[model samples]
Target chain A: MGVGPSTKETSLHHFRDPLVDIVGSDSGIDLMGVLVFGSPEGNEEKIRCSRTAAVVAECCRPDGVIVETDGWGNLDVDYVNCVNEIGERGIPVAGLNWSGTAGTFVVDSPYLDNVVDFNKNPEGIESNIVGENNYTADDVRECVKRLKIAMLKKGMNK
Target chain B: MGVQEIDLRRLVIKSFHMTDVQMGDENKITMDGKLTIDGSYVKDLAERHSKVIEKIDIQIIQPGDHDRYTNTIMDIIPISTKVLGKCGEGITHTVTGVYVMPTGVDVDGEQAHEFGSSEGNLKDMLYLNRAGTPSDTDIIISFDITFKKGMGQERHAIIEAYHAVDEWIQVYREQMKKFNGNKATEKHEYHDVIRPGQKKVLIIKEMIAHGAMLDTWIFPNEPSGVAGGKSLIDYGCMPVMLTPNEFRDGAIHSMN
Candidate 1:
């Protein structure tokens, strides 16, 4: 997972914090540690970080994993690669990104599915309003549900 | 910082809508939604920066006229002025439906500003109506500034270009101060409040202040205007804290 700048307004919640809270509060889900990483400066480093993060997540032995990114464009390269690394290990994975219209995924993979685009702008672009197009409580809930379904299909109960 | 039980401050922004813009003998916004720019003032502004600025061509780009060619866009500036109090907490008067775009190139035709110059048709080069771009209904005031030979790559010369445009916009800023609050097309109020029982959150913004074309400015006199701001490079790239209202009020003026 990735975290970027705070939204413009103070009253709204950042996507990462609320998502963590929701997962932590759930009795059925055993939440692992959050992995906060910076944007790698080079392509080789980005790939290295992706594989390393996937290995760490696999060591925790979670039934399902959700990878999210707050940005698009070149950052998508690492985001998709990280998800692919996890999926290649036979782990179920989903994604969360801002790809509703203007930022539609430039690259995709068979390992990537059930992506939630939390864009709220009517024009489907970055409206600049604080928390307008960010992940909400409802979006987070949907992502959790998808993860549960993926686990259930694999005969694993969270 | 911990939360306290007090309202930090409040800011009220009043906006006047402008539908059209044209070059004329005087600089003023009419009551009927037209903005006229005095050509002589622009000529004088160019002369004032003669050491760095060689020639300036001002064009009034109508809405939807993005097929025309332009130099690399240096900045997209909003015209706003402080009517009362300071920047974060005060009455601000601003103009809507128009934006100022400063484009630059050297006398040798080398693009200034970005590492990769986006000098092409405005339509192809810009993603309009985005967070940092002009809307589809905006009237653009394009300041095409050609710098002296080899001056485009100089940090000080580029700063002078931005300063010159800021000075030119001051003419309209003065006019904005006189706009009646009741005549404003839109009004918004923002406040900085502390919620005691709520969880605390801090957002970190990463900015580039490496000299020569990549820099960020903070706390200009006017919203998104380039005058009276401190460069991040000068601050040694230290981390700065700002209240949410301050960020929404345009405290960070990105020069890249």
Candidate 2:
């Protein structure tokens, strides 16, 4: 199958149905969505995407999003807007910008890790988001790990 | 009145074995055991009078073995006193009581080892030192009864004894708290920072017994390769130490 758009439409199509099933329609908590924005800089796209994802995830409710961006420095406006909306709702969002194909970025949450990656070109970006082409699974694991630590630290301080 | 002399009886020493292990690998070793006047005797003596056995003190003596020098540790095993009978003496109530031993006593291995000579046989003498050292020691339970035989009083002395024991336990608990250290009150800080481009690293920190911190890591990203440090003292995590106060307040707001 040909690769599809890594925009808000695609993430919604993939995640919204499952999230609805989990939270239920009348539960009053919506599973907000994630938006991945390509870095304006050439080499820093992965870092930008990761930083944005961390910030967005903190702003949103936990377990609300999976942001995917093609590593080739192209911004997805609609997805960005969805991230903003989720941010407004206080749901957390996380973004993965793959160096190669958008499908390659690792999708991770506190409870989930090493999700399905279908990208073909591993070398297309500075950092491969998942598997061998990227940093080891341990690195990806730390991203979520440190985020949780930060969250807990934030919780205890208050 | 001139001073009168009261003769004191020597408490008989009974044989006992170390039954419990407090720590380390080697388990139960037997030691020379001694018998003190069972605490129940005080209650029995007090029953003839119209008074209660408030407290009793016993001295422990070590009977030395001839073959080897033996050192023995002594522990006071408290026995529970259950209520037996209560009665009225004419117009007043008098309580009568009896005391019994609850369970066997415990002895320690060090005491047992001391009894073992170079020949590997246990020595005969149960040694008593000025220092209060305990062998395998255990608390014993005893009971008391307040009601006497001839009087009309009905409540047993054991009920009052139970109250006394309860008060004693409370006192012991307070003393233990003081000995263990002050209750932990202060908040602690934990920090971890990840630099860019490093991979295959993890950080872990936890609180261990006696409020010690344990930190460990796997595949650390730093070139120095060390991934662990602990807080100097016991502390709870707080917001200001972890995040800017404004950010923490905002985060709390978001969570709410």
User: Taking the candidates one at a time, how many backbone clashes does each contain?
Assistant: 0, 53
Task: Give residue A146's error in model 1 in angstroms.
Answer: 15
The TM-score of predicted model 1 comes to 0.65
Residue B135 miss distance in model 2 (angstroms): 64
Model 2 TM: 0.18
lDDT of 1 by residue, A8-105 (tens): 11111221144554554444554543443333435675566666667766775667777766656555766777778878997877666777676777
Docking class of 2: incorrect
lDDT of 2 by residue, B106-162 (tens): 121111111111111112221111011112232121222222332111112322332
lDDT string for model 1 (B77-100, tens) is 777788888766788877778878
| DockQ of each candidate relative to the true complex | 0.05, 0.01
Query: Candidate 2: deviation at residue B199, Å?
Result: 25
> lDDT of all predictions, in order shown?
0.67, 0.23
Query: What is model 1's DockQ versus the real complex?
Result: 0.05
- Give me the displacement of residue A9 in model 1, in angstroms: 17
All candidates: TM-score: 0.65, 0.18
State interface RMSD in Å for all models: 11.0, 27.9
Best by lDDT: 1
Docking class for candidate 1: incorrect
Top candidate on TM-score is 1
